[model samples]
Target chain A: MALASETPRPRTWWRRNQQRLTPWLFLAPGMAMFVFYVIYPIIASFRLSLYDYDGLSAPEWLGLANYAELWTDPAFTTSLYNNVLWLVLYLLAVPAGLFIAIFLNQAVMGIRIYKSLFFFPFVISQVVVGLMFAWFYAPNFGLLYNVIEYFTGKGVAILADPDLATYGIIAAGLWPQIAYVMILYLTGLNNVAPDQVEAARLDGAKGWKMLWYVILPQLRPATFIAVVVTVIGALRSFDLVSIMTNGGPFGSTRVLSYYMYEQALSEYGYRMGYGAAIAVVLFAIMMVFISGFIWKMVRDERGVH
Target chain B: MLHLRTGAYAALAVLLGTTAMAQQRTLNYYADFDPAPLAAFEAAIADFEAANPDIDVVLQNFDHEGYKTAIRNFLTTDAPDLANWYAGNRMAPFVAAGQFMDVSDVWADNGLDQSLGSALASMTIDGKQWGVPYTYYQWGIYYNKDVYAQVGVEVPATWDAFVANCEKFSAAGIDCLTTGTSALWPGAGIFDYLNLRTNGYEHHMKLTGGEIPWTDDSVRATFAEWAKVQPHITENHAAIDWQDAATLLVQGKAANYVMGNFAVAVFKEGGMTDETLGFMPFPTINPDVARAEEAPTDTIHIPAGAKNVEDAKKFLAFIAQADTQTKLNMALGQLPINAGSTVGDDPFIKAGFELLSTTPGGIAQFFDRDAPAEMAKIGMEGFQQFMVQPDQLDAILERLEAARSRIYK
Candidate 1:
């Protein structure tokens, strides 16, 4: 009996240290995956940015040279400028989503079907959406081209026009993005405090005023998620641009993501080192927003406690 | 019952082990092809597997554009035994990087040096042939005979006569040359022909090889000649792709399309018959300069890191045979490199074969194939922009010259 008691019983060990060890055991796989996939690649990409590798050969060390070249590259400048335009304009979808959500928030007959219909675009793949928009904006036989020609006496080929191509693609991106945000807001609206809205209505608060002062305050979590996703989506805008324009009509629609792809893998030549530098820049931009969101969440948690 | 089940499992395991041992030599082939040529290659693969029963041929095919991206990754990691590639400067980088095997011994053992004929030189780099070229085709002006008759002109053999015919087409209010520059390569086709005619083949090759500057006087002279005929080209060309431009030719809305012979199939599919569709060589620009045609050849190579190197070489030799080439190219609707290989009775194939074989200055692999891909992209983009705004020539050339210096360095 003494020898048996001296041995380590796994059941007793689990009982004694369960709370401390269980959470960490649960987190181990996820943490290991995040470290391997996300953290390791970021560090490796940073290291690769300082070299000159053509992907098929041994890498040559060229510290800061690739970054230095990017400073004067006309294509890089155009891509960065277009990325800024994308970020600024992509935010318009959030407000547009809110507007659509409010308009359909009523309990009218067959409104459930209408809500599902409104969420339809978000379910379709971005590639299909891009193709649909491309056909819609096609030069001679497209719907938009014909409509424009009927009014202006000249058809506008949106994807083929360098000045307007990015805008056309962003409009395609917004179709699905707006649908996604509207679904989020609709769910948030379902959980809104009705008593507060009714009290505000008694105090002469109605329509835009009530939505602003009373309802929006309750919709803060939804709004925060909407903004976060929109920001990330804007920065990662690649599929629509790739499908519709391919950075064509003189490389005018290229974003940092597409430009990096063109440099790293496209027929332009496999300059992996240069491509890594572009990715680092895009990541740095994304980190700013990511950190801010985390900081706000931490402060909110502390206030709640 | 338990004893019988275990016995059955042991037998099955032994059978699998023997089958695996028998299929020891497996050769992997990575191919990039359009649907039409892919069928031909598939048939050839079947024949090769049947001929060499001991060797197993594993084939993976990717579409043309997707393969371009996938090659860079696969060639370095998990490389196939053999992979399809292009010749000339297209293969130069891989050769320089030591990614492809030096298959000169296969060339010698099979007498490919004689069989390959004109393509042998292009396949060779640094005194060693890197790959075997299977098929190639010619690029020329495909014109509408009905439009030619409507404009009251014949096929012009010289540059001056071509310009006069364009003038007649202009008088008749039909665009003489319908090209799609939205994709940017059709415009480069025009630039290639003009340079080949004016400055000759050597200079054109040198320019694409990045030995000559974009702002050189010869290049400027080619552009000057091109500008003279710019008004005859289709307007608002940036809006449509090559197929749409070909549609204009099929509809008789445009007179001519300077493209590869592959476009003949498109024209035929668009209801154009032999009487309406005709092929002509790009008109002569310099009386003294010999004609050099754009005939891009498609080649296949064995990767240096391939596991089944000996079997790969055997496959290469088998495909290098004239009979194999004839069967393959005949199915592909392209001209085979071997003189003994017979192409289809298709008149365009005959004309392409005759033109490429008879040309004094030989062939080029088109702009995109000849030049480094980075420089080619910028060069084609500049060509497209120039088509839109010809007055921006100096600025465009300056930009291209800068890109050339950076890329070639």
Candidate 2:
């Protein structure tokens, strides 16, 4: 009994409560902010989606009229197509970033400066990025036009042409997005287990095979983060649309977010209900991707044990 | 000396008491114009303060885009005493809800029609005057004289002449036209012009109001007509800023531009010599369409809850007078709404007023202002897209029809 009393327990009573209480405490601040700003508004918007509120009238309960209208809306359809295009093309940022990060991972004098300069676009405001791209693509006066004219004998104003305008805007959007993913990969590469990499190298693995078989498997967290950011960035592509074309060259650039603005807040009309419905539809589409991500995360969490 | 001091104290007490009363019953007045109108309004409000000495007028200013949305939202929030709003179908939905105060009584009491002309019609909804008309502007053609002169193209007055002029400019490698179409917003006038010419004013109104279907022959013909002049416009105009288009005209990069008269400032800012600048109505498309050629009046309004409604009405009355309109118009280089208000010494203003007075027929409001916003956006984008690629008409119209069906329904 004396020896038992003298011995130290691995966990105290406080430690027994820690696993249960610590997570809640750590989560409290983020949870509070998330519930207040993000979750509550989403529920509020879903509630708002059911009403025929002009934002001026007392919100009238209109059942699913807003949702019904969405099915028939060509504007909604156009925006949906553009959004799909954005999502698909935005994935290029990940691979492009990875490639750039690999190229940048060289031992040279002033390499740090080169990396920061490469990542500079990401730090700049999207508005500034958009403006720079607009100037860069301006028909007769832009740098791209000068290059194209030198090569092709015809300078195409990319933003002014309907067939190419969305792509042009998307390209502008990708400039910074690629940089962001590159920085993520750079960080991931910095944390890469050199011992494991050296062991894999001793087995005569290198280049694409080396990256694929060894390096990338260790880059799981960075890739996951990069994917999350890219998906979110693609969906929230309003600034570039607003600045570059404003969903113009005939509404061809209208993404879901911009179309929602066009529907609700624009001089076009105060169709808050219609806009809310569009938002809900977009939210639903995002939720699909989100569920997949969450499922993967849950599996990873279980694997951690 | 004591008697004089007593008298001074009495007057001071009265002034303080009046100011205190005004503080309690202050009314907020909102507007969207620049400082000139606001300055004039504040000056008038001072006069109002000296007169009523109780009801204070709080002046609020918003940018034009913000004003449009704010007015719509104000029906839910703290509405201003008075505000500036557009006329036509733009005002219809709001007026339908009886959200705006009916100023017909004040309007009639002022004998507004005698002085204001049909300009008041812009503000009328369902035969009721909902707000007091304050300031309005004309929309028409603003052009570069040096470019026209260099290209040897006269400002076309007739339909045949306009097309020929466009052909000449195109042959000369000069872009004959320019306007903004980037947002499918403010720069939708070209589509409105084609519709106005093809079916005349009534059909233009009907089509824009969602009363006529998009598949209507009148609308089709309008699209057909615009497709003819597609090549004459500046290359990459869809990407050009309207202000920059005016800049282009001023810089001799383009020959002509169709926009509101407010662009006169932009031309001057571009360093175009005043003699090099010229203004005219849009050339007739059908010749028999009875085109006013000139768009009409800049607008101002009193919102739903004005504290100094009586004073505001008085100020509106004062502004409506021929002399005051002339003074304000001359100061701003805009054409005065009142008939007898003579154009000032500014050559462009003189030419603009000359076009307005000499032009025979009804003045139609520009598309974005005249057509409800949704139709305006769709119509403009479709027209612009179609102009760039003519083969898209059927698809454009189908999409428009889908949009129209939703909006109209």
Candidate 3:
């Protein structure tokens, strides 16, 4: 008792609390980074949305004027509409990926080679993919243009037409996105229980029935991941739009992400507050999905515990 | 003890070096120049250093496109002593934000009023000179002479004749006018020429300066003029780049291209000799309107936060000198802004010099330079849209009018 009393008080406190504090100490660096890089910027973007800033001049408090302008801005509407189109069209990757994964699942001659070939698009850079698709859709001497010209009397330039340009870019984005989804589903398929498949077969479940009842349930984790990634990917679709059309043929191809960049940072753009407002709207939209995801994840984690 | 001795020596060296640097003032200059022009500027810098032995000029080169975005950041955060930018309304935002230094004293002390008289109006804002222009290039119709000869068309001297030639060229299975509007600025060249030809320089300036409404009939007249040639502009032009359009002109698929003088290099590279490539002033639209020309001037300015203001002014004065501009522009293959500067012997250069120097109405900067950036962007898109769908002219004009009201205010 005399020895315990003689020991330093802070040292005893540290020894007593070390177990509870250890994990937090380990987490401190990463948490600090997240707060600084991610949380801080998001809060700052929210604050900036209420101001009018040209980046060169001091930011003036405008009190939601930028947001009000977004409602009236035609470009903002077009961008929002295109973003919806991208989200709906981009979701097509999941089923298409599942189909490809199933088709390529069988063991055949050089199956690995075929699988690798199928996975190749996702492995290449988005910029290169965008460039390739751009060339393919280019008018006059492009291969697709020539083919179309041969079929019809007049050639159609996909990117030149405002009505078709967004769809064309989305199609380009899907080429690699489908491949990415396929790889995820392939891994998920590998983990399916053979005993369950056998049991289902015994119960007269086959083909469509087998997949719907047994295979899909087992693939839920992969499907969840694929959907999450695709949602994020669709929202942040900037590079392909930048490389392919630069949101052009009269701003018809602008998605929300690209429009935000155009308003704040592009050669003609220095409207910081306006860009931040757009960013805020985008963040609010993203939060809906993210919160839904987090809610589900938390409930599932609780169930597991 | 040995480590302490080494640390002491290092500190001594740094102290001596800093004192030495302090004796010779350093002027940091940021410029965006292509390879050839960079070499020319380097040579000019060498001469400047030789002339002013006490000053050191350190030039940091940036990529052309990246420099536009970078300048905004650096000007506010870490400004250089000197930086390169465009003249007219292109510099207005920077000038208004107090990012650029007012260099009226530099112009006054150097007598630039007489020497660089051609660029005086463009360099001035709020009745004060903000920068010194070094080089400018003319915008006009660059054509394929071989295609014109094959199609049995004469070089048009008037807008009516030009439209007439367009029909003949289109009948001959060649595009009359070819411009790639994918980047959008190329279409602005066409608009600038059309507006200048239709309403003269004063009206064009007023239109770009936000004094005139886009819904005005005068602006509509320019679009009506544009509509005359719209059908004959190359199909799928919105998908192709300027270089690709140049290729079309080279291959005789397009007869004419409304472009700046810099496209000559692309034409030459595509195997078109000087004999086959031709330059003509944009044809007359209205006989009553005085002939104006588009010559976009590129200038350099000292940043407001510059440390070496005196030396920076000296550098600007040196750049404005006739001999310096002549040599610089010779290497740039562009026309010098200084009135006393001599142009090179290139045929295109000579043609541009003659065309600009003899203009009766005035010299106007290109559309993107003349108008505020947001207006320029929206206007160019509207122009591109008009080229695609002439029926949307009313809607496009309304949109532009809306933008102008918001932006200018």
Candidate 4:
């Protein structure tokens, strides 16, 4: 009431400029939050990477020492290798998802139910998927163990073997990832211009030829989204690795995300600065992909305009 | 309108007064992740509150693994009045940073020196007691008595007897030790026992303190001794968890397992009784070396950031009482550190009490608790690797030595 009584000058100014300023005013709150939570933290983490902190004492400035240490650290090398493995393996989901989407695209009885059933794993959390897969691969009594033993007379404990553990987790991760991609492709298929398919059929283009020459190019937008999400998900593969192996048998399953968490937290006792360094590396890797995607999107937008 | 505003102010003051009168004080207590212990802890708090009605205890329990990470966050900001944490080197960093309130006065006032003698040294830092030691349990070789009887071998006290027993168990088609190294720490237990038995407790302390290198002769001997038992351990042991390994022991497929006294509950849950389960200290490698056992102690502390110092002190004193310790440990299936507390009739508890109380070289907290956490993580990983491939001892040691030197500095 006091401000209203005293602010005629401010009110007159607002009335004069509100038309031009309304859009920015509307965006201010959200943009400020983004800057604080996202942009500020990224800058802070980069700064912290140059110091040595244990989240307790005052941080000591050791510019580039953490980065220097990373080169010689075998654990870092292993984590980097595993991250690349995850990236390469995770891309397999896009095509697998498209295949499943095509298979389920028919107008059959209870087809909707079948679609939802195929999308079940994606609906559940990654933690649950990891647990289910852990059970499925458990040494003596797991379903996978039983099947393998039936054929070879020896059960394979997939998660227990360090050499095999990361691949096992990646496979578990792909179960839901594939479902996600399938849903995206299903949505894309719905809007895929049915006339084109019919026209291609009239030209006697069918099966793989039809999919390759007609359907796939039309589904590029969905493919783009699937590839983007898969890349992000693969790099952020901490939950399954943490839940299943905890980067064990001997830290063999650590990706950059899990390794950063282990350093920053866990009973390993906060090496926050070193953890920040790892995060910076992960962020730089992610930025390369993000920038490429954004560049393509911008080019597409320009072409559309 | 003026009269109405006056009345609203009067009412607010009255409500605040009544609330303050009704609940005079609150003590925020954060408990560690252990459901059974939390139950007993609640009971103890109930008694304390009844005796001192002015103070109200607000308790929150955390999941064990989550709590391990959350403590670092909460201890520095929004600290609870009292927190449950491990003793020994695990508590050292928090103490060194002055996050924990030194309650030496409480110890003096309550005469806890007499009751908590067993865990005093571990809880003390820089001549001050930072926390109250409540409960601790012993770690030893947990064996299936049925297998031992069938094999006709008695409890082994010397290294030679231990190896011969393992050989006998192996000959009888039972794996000698059923341990899960997938989590990494179980393998460290084997390392702890071997180091304590071979080099004595002093050397073990020196090594954990980073005064001794990993490639030291005494450390090599400890690993060398551990290598002998590697042959008799379960195949593909890293693939299973401790509970799974315990299942093998309970099912009589494996002869023995080395674990903390906590496994007694798991074995009991597996349908084994006190009669079939036997507990023995890790055998002595050097008869002349004083016997130091692994007994991890759990302590309660008032974080320095706490709001209720007086109440937290009172709570700590109440927790240190023999009755409280007895009930807490009894519920948790562990031993009370209170010297005056009676050990429950559970034979395993009795044996643990007997072993820990009588150790001439005193009880060292387990490997993960005794060493700095980062070094401990790397060291335990090395131990696990060595168990899987005994020939990689030198490489593992070199890696551990590198980590240890870097961490300690």
Candidate 5:
């Protein structure tokens, strides 16, 4: 009895709380990593936005100067405008993917082969896609150039024209993004309730009505995922712009992410503070959509429970 | 027991290895050299090592593009004894940040002020020499002789004659001037020549030094000269790379290319023999202005944080030697910066040597090297924009002026 009373208090406490503490202990390592890499950097970037640093010398405090400069900077404005264009145009991938998914979701012979072929683009690296598309749009001897020349008597170099370069890069990005969305919807379509689909078909619901009323409702999870991925992809578009245009023909094709890189780290750029300010703005823009997504997810979980 | 004995043996071996390394000084060199130049540099290092048997030189080669970013990181965190960089304002940032060691004493000891005189000004910042220049290649018009002959045109001696030749070339459906601005620096080469010719070396220096406003009238005058050939430049050049444009010149679709001597190799590789390829000085734009040339010097500097400063300085002195530079540039197929060094028998190298040696006006580094980096990027983009849309000249100038105000301050 004396020994039982003298048992270490810490061990007893651990025993008492083991059920709750075990999960948290398991989560500790991952949570620590998340705090160090993700949370810390976000806060650091916010603080860095107010300083004037060139990545070599000491950072000078500048208050709101970096943010204020962004408001007046023409390059920043162009990047913002291009980002908006990307966001609007990038959403088109979701519907296009849905259409392709429906078309490929069939029981015909060799449908799997066709589906895989359609999914091939997503598997390829972004750099390769950018290179392929660059060649396709190249002037003089490119395939698209030759075809356009045959039709219009003069080939258009889409990447060279400031008015069209952003669109050209966006089209390249959509090629792979659409493939990714289609794959997601394809998997979603497999789990759909076939009985509901049959009921709608028997009720004389045709193509559009049946899709809108029964199929799409069942594909809500897929649609939500597609929208979220597409939005994130649009916001973080650096690779295609870097590969295809490099914000050239007078920086016309720059998106926010690429512009931030240009301001901070490119061969000619070392304005870390200005880059941080641009990053802060981009983060804020993303937070709006991300928070909306989180709110919706929480509400959906509550409703389900 | 056997495993424990083996582990003990491995530990002893590591300890011995470290002790041996500590006994001999190691000079770490970080360089970004293409295959040809890398071989030349390695050969030079062998000679240096043979002379000083105790000092070991360790070389870490990086890809050219990646090195630009890597140098910034390593210079701060893990500095090497030696680093390869460029001359002029390109090195200004490192100098200003005190990341590069001041090597004036080495220059004084070696009498480099006389032998490396041509690049002396470029290597100097605030009256102190920070690096040693080994090689610089000339920039001029490399033309397709066959294209010139087919168009029934002779190489021009004056700007007007060049403009006239452009009309004839255009009538034959040939691009008069071809450059790829996708990377954006090629267009600056053209601007450099025009600015150098129109305003002479002093004014050009003033303009790039940010003393003169970008929207100044003299700057507009240079643009006005550029306007003459804007339409005759290759269409859709913004989508192509410099090598692709070189292909156009090689195929005789383009008559002339205002490029550095490096393009001569590309021209030769594309099946142009010595007879088919011809080099000429950029024509006399304003005969009154003394002739200036563009020869961007490649240099080596000692990092401030370098551990083996003495051996690194010895390496610099060896690189500055006339014979060493002569042999190095021979392999590099470039012009040696040492005045006493002899150039090879290559016709392009000879022509460049002659063109640069006799220039009364001072030599200007290429535009990107001469100007601050931010200004250079904005300026090159503006040049590309102007090439595509001459109508946007006002907008482009205003934009550059705005950038200048923000960047130079």
Candidate 6:
């Protein structure tokens, strides 16, 4: 007791100013980057949405006008409807990818090569994929056209029909998106505990039941990733739409992003303020998933300790 | 310490200002055409510098197809000193926004009215001239002589004859028309021709500028006529790029191609020279309206934000000079914009002049260029959808009218 009192214990640097300096120092670079690239742009876009600025000219404020017009615009409705269709159709990729991943998980000769081959579409540029699918669906001479003609006694020019054009583009989009989902599932399958599978098998679990009870339970982490990826992919489905259709065949394939681009910065004209309003709506839609994700992540963090 | 800091900043400022001032002011020439034009521009620049002795010019060419997208992004940032753009309705949005310099004083001061053709009226919107048209060429039918000969049809010079020739070609198992709708602009030209013939230039002006109904009777009639001719067209027009359609002419597979003067190079490159290719004016169905101007012309403008605006203007003015205009187009085989400018000995260029001079009505900017881009897109897509399935015409029109109302509001 005398020794403990005789010499005061030296405090750590953190022990003195840790609360004040630590959060800031840890946050400095990341916070700066977030401010510069993400936060500022969001704020700027929000501010820009209140204007009628064509990018080349000075901005003019017509507050709430862009939003007012957006409400009454038929094109916006068409785009929003198509976006919903993309979201619904895009969810198919996750399950399709899981089945593919499970099928390819069997041990066999050249299985690695087969897996990579399956993964090829996702690795290829979306632009190239769009072009290939376009060729595949090309009216008369396309491979799919020939196959359909062989059976139906007629050639189906999928892209030219406004009724079918959006679906055609979405099918092309799935070619790559499924491949991305498959790769994620393949990774998850590698980490799935074999002990659980063996126990479930001993308990007389059979094919679909085995998967539903044992395999899927172990693959939650991968499912989470796959669902999040699919959601974001569905939301940001612009590149393929641009390359394949450009929202053509009577604007049948126009999504919110492409429509926003068309509104604010297309060869047609610049309506920057109107474009920003469209962007805000899209952001609000995306925020739904983002908030859920954040809530889940926070729950997971709390559960971590 | 304060004095030293002030002196240091003053010296730095002087250094920067002086460096910026004497930096040998290199002029940037951003264009969408081939290297041939840039190469020619350099030769012109050589002579210009030989006279001025104080400026430098740098020529950059983007892939013709990609340049439009590139220029769109570039214009929002620090753009080049001088860039090439289309005149008429194409330049209006840019000019209206004041992104481009007002070259009106330059035009008046240089007596451009006396030098350039009165056809420059298309480039002038709202009484302010924003750019000097470097050159322009008219649009017309470029038919394959071999295919036409095989089908035993002569070049049609009148509206009735044009349809008759199309029927002849269709009967002979040849696709009379081929175009691309992949990007929408190529197919947009089809609407231009239809609208030009059906409604004439004035109605086109009112309709494209959001002044008339997209479902107007005249517009519907244009699509109705297009539907009749649609079946004679290629099976997959979207499969072919505009150049690829021209290649069909070269291959003797197709009967005719309706295109602007820009397509001559493609035909020539494919070995369909003057002897193999024949040209005619866009036949006038309504011979009553005779405005006698030209179609979409190309312009080169110095941006208001250009660092070297004066020098950029000097370069553009030099390009507009009679001697340079003659030489440049002579090499590129384009029609010159200057009134006294000659096409030299190129057959294609000479044919272009004949087409423009003989066509009873004035030329018009292509539908996509002349109309507001939004309305133009809807109208053109409506036409394309109609062509594929004529049953959709009424629904397409009603939808377009809805879009039209929104734009006007």
lDDT of each model, Cα atoms only? 0.89, 0.77, 0.93, 0.89, 0.93, 0.79
What order do you get sorting by TM-score, best first?
5, 3, 4, 1, 2, 6
Clashing pairs in 3: none
The CAPRI-style docking tier of model 1 reads medium
* Residues B4-120 of candidate 2: C-alpha lDDT, one tens digit per residue: 113356567446756656454555566776766656555555655666565555555677667777777665466666666766767767776667777777668867776666576
TM-score of every candidate = 0.92, 0.89, 0.96, 0.92, 0.96, 0.88
iRMS values for every prediction: 1.8, 1.5, 0.6, 1.4, 0.6, 2.9
Q: Residue A62 deviation, candidate 1, in Å?
A: 0.6
Q: Report how far residue B138 has shifted in candidate 3, in Å.
A: 0.5
Off by over 4 Å in 1: A1-19, B1-25, B46-56, B167-173
Q: What's the true lDDT of residue A243 in model 5?
A: 95
Report residue A243 deviation for candidate 3 (angstroms): 0.6
lDDT for each residue of candidate 3 in B206-253, tens digit (9 for 90 to 100)? 999999999999999999999999999998889999999999999999
Chain B TM-score (model 2 vs. true structure): 0.87
Off by over 4 Å in 5: A1-11, B1-22
Q: Which 10-residue window of candidate 6 chain B scores lowest in summed lDDT?
A: B1-10
Q: Which digits, one per residue and each the tens of the lDDT, describe model 3 over residues A1-305?
A: 78977856566788989999999999999999999999999999999989989998889999978989999999999999999999999999999999999999998999999999999999999999999999999998777888999999788899999999999999999999999999999999999999999999999999898889899999999999999999999999999999999999999999999999999989987898999999999999999999999999999999998
True contacts kept of each: 0.58, 0.79, 0.90, 0.73, 0.88, 0.46
Q: Grade the docking of candidate 5.
A: high
lDDT of 4: 0.89
lDDT per residue, candidate 4, B256-299, as tens digits? 88899889889999989989988888888998899999988888
Residues B1-409 of candidate 1 have per-residue lDDT tens digits of 0011123565674466457757557777888878888778888888987887777776777778888778877888879899999998899888999999999999998888988878987898899999999999999999999999887898999988988888899888888899987677898899999999999999998999889999999999999988988888887577578998999899888998899988999999999988889999999999899998999999999988899999999999988889999999999889999877888899899999999989899799889988998888899989887877789899899999999898987
Worst 10 residues of 4 chain A by lDDT: A4-13
Model 5: clashing residue pairs?
Answer: none
- Native-to-model Cα distance after best TM-score fit, residue B37 in candidate 6, in Å: 1.8
